[model samples]
Target: MTPDLFGRHRAVLPDWLALYYEDPLEITHGEGRHVWDAAGNKYLDFFGGILTTMTAHALPEVAKAVGEQAGRILHSSTLYLNRPMVELAERVACLSGIPDARVFFTTSGTEANDTALLLATAYRRSNTILAMRNSYHGRSFSAVGVTGNRGWSPTSLSPLQTLYVHGGVRTRGPYAHLGDREFTDACVDDLKDLLGHTRAPAALIAEPVQGVGGFTSPPDGLYAAFREVLHERGILWIADEVQTGWGRTGEHFWGWQAHGQNGPPDIVTFAKGIGNGMSVGGVVARAEIMNCLDANSISTFGGTQVTMAAGLANLAYLLEHDLQGNARRVGGLLLERLRSVAARVPHVREVRGRGLMIGVELTRPGTDEAAPEAASAVLEEARAGGLLIGKGGGHDTSALRIAPPMSLTVAEAEEGAAILERALRSV
Candidate 1:
């Protein structure tokens, strides 16, 4: 019996709130890398709720931490001395690689980015922000302002004067045809030129791997090169590591390390996987920038004891088990397997990403034209074959995203790859 819940959902929820699939799925429960629909259909979850579930679903440590914290205190505002928050902050600061790093926790990535913008603008005394093309920061007014993707940015009204930068998406821009070194030089030249025209900007923000832009990234050390120019101009570099943090990229715990020649970013914002599903977002910055705001500020719900408890427990588990190493090993296997599968499919234009954060861009066969329809078809087909994935791209949602839990096993990777191959073939 088909439920009328979908009809009710449409009636109550705002239409603009995007849902996947023509028939949106209702996940009843999840365990490990798999989830069950309300109707009892089991599927291997590849996207892992946009890579928020860094570890496996229903991990015992996280569950115990949340459960224990709830038994004691659900939440205490920032006014209270929150032990768990302090502990987690210390850990994040140590991990952040920023000198004299201070941590400010928020409930979501959007709020974290908003706080970062606040600190950067206040410190530099400039409202001008530079962001990468095809980047999606968040939904807040200020975050959306720096977002360079037209499809995601809903309004032109912004308090900040934003300049869109190049090199975030290296696959299909005017400089795409250039070699890695050449592309780096070209993008650097472009940035210098853009900066010459604009007033002094507060900061330049970028994602090491653009999540919603279909896992695209510039050549290694591109940001390092840009950092050199920005440093000379006294502009801060803010790395939005919401998706790329926590060894998701395998080689680096933090995404900025790929461009670490410039040392740590002036400010870094992270969310999504740190809490392993708990709503934990935070910003890490040097003492100077963090202390710029003179007025009193506090996040009532930010750094709540319960969420902090969850974060501490989760981080402990991730490090103890060496999930970062697991990500590197298994992610390498998965990436190689995906490439093999994509090589056989003409519709698969490019397979890209680091670690489990992978994307297979779809295109009209033998052409560069994006094939969002083919991507959608592959998604539906994958779901039918008991596999769950995600789709995203700057060009009309033309890339299939695959990011399973960090604890993914060899057999599971092979299983998901087979299912994805079948789906691509069907499409």
Candidate 2:
């Protein structure tokens, strides 16, 4: 018997494996901050493809680079040196600000984080890793193990000795204990106690802005204290900037910059917008940490000609247009508008985040429990009204995370916020 043209057994696709069904409406094409589905309906793209399309879709320069490079050479083993690969590595290293910093490219953010973890373990000669609870590193086996979320399964190596700290959620009780000086002291003391009790850890990895952890930024002096403790104890710090890199935050090129100088991690992993949705991720390290990798360790598809070309064009596009400044201006406007909505809406628990990476947190209409469902309702209604928004889950309720292209404008920001306001009201 012959199979259907599209495929046989659509049931297998739906039921065979794990799924994240809450994803947004299907998108066919996008330009700037606007996208359309197969039905030709348009929607404002505030989600920016989960913070990967900071430069937007079908960017002419990036497209041209990809096409031109594909016309010439699309496949090349790392055994042979390539022009685009070499130049991209040099450019990334130069922009990253660590003199002598090296770039090891990968196919996705998880691979980059995995590579960073490997180097950290080898450098420290230790298996224990300290990660912040509520932190999201990635979904690879090792990366998932380091990730603080419990719903995500344990890695193949379950006994890897991953230590987690109170990333913003205390296991003991309410987070009200985290607001004051005494609470901060207690958190720090808890961290110190953990470090004292555990074996030496290979690395401490975190997101400068906790992405999946409800878009929360750390407390004042919190990152500084963590850095002091980690450095004092010889634990390597890894900043997983997969969702926060490439000028989305508006303050600086990377989200760690939002934390000021005190948030410099020993190693930084970047993906998402580094190539504006192109499949490219890289690990940049301080000279000391990067030097630990053996020379023969390399992946075949880590840096491809087409991907490198696209990355080069995207980086050039970012610098040429001063998109970072645009993000700051428009992001600030979006924040103000969202804050205004929060003021009027009874369910908004908090309006937190910076620049384009903003979150509209919701609580029960009159209760204290996280309105995770309300947030979902808001997202569903917004989509019905021709706007695209994304949702984040974890500890508290849920948040509608808005991270549009850096090219998004103040006018667009206001319009998107207005649509969100309508969605919230309907919900």
Candidate topping lDDT: 1
Q: Candidates' lDDT values, in order?
A: 0.93, 0.79
lDDT of 2 by residue, 1-427 (tens): 1135114334456543332224424468988789987668898988877888878788999999999999999869687898999999998888776657888889899999999999999899998988877777777888888887654545447535798887454222345545556656777788899988888898888887878776776655565677788888788878788988877778888766644455467788998887888889999998878888676676788889999999999999998999988988888988988898888899887788887888777888776577877887888888877778777746443778888888887788888888999998886
For each of the candidates, give the backbone clash count.
0, 0
Model 1 residue 30 CA deviation in Å = 1.0
Q: For model 1, how does the per-residue alpha-carbon lDDT over 323-377 read when each residue is reduced to its tens digit? A: 8888889999999999999999999999998888899999999999999999999
Q: How far is candidate 2 from the true structure (C-alpha RMSD, Å)?
A: 3.3
lDDT of 2 at 421: 91
- Provide the lowest-lDDT 10-residue window in model 1: 1-10
Q: What TM-score, computed on C-alpha atoms, does each candidate reach?
A: 0.99, 0.91
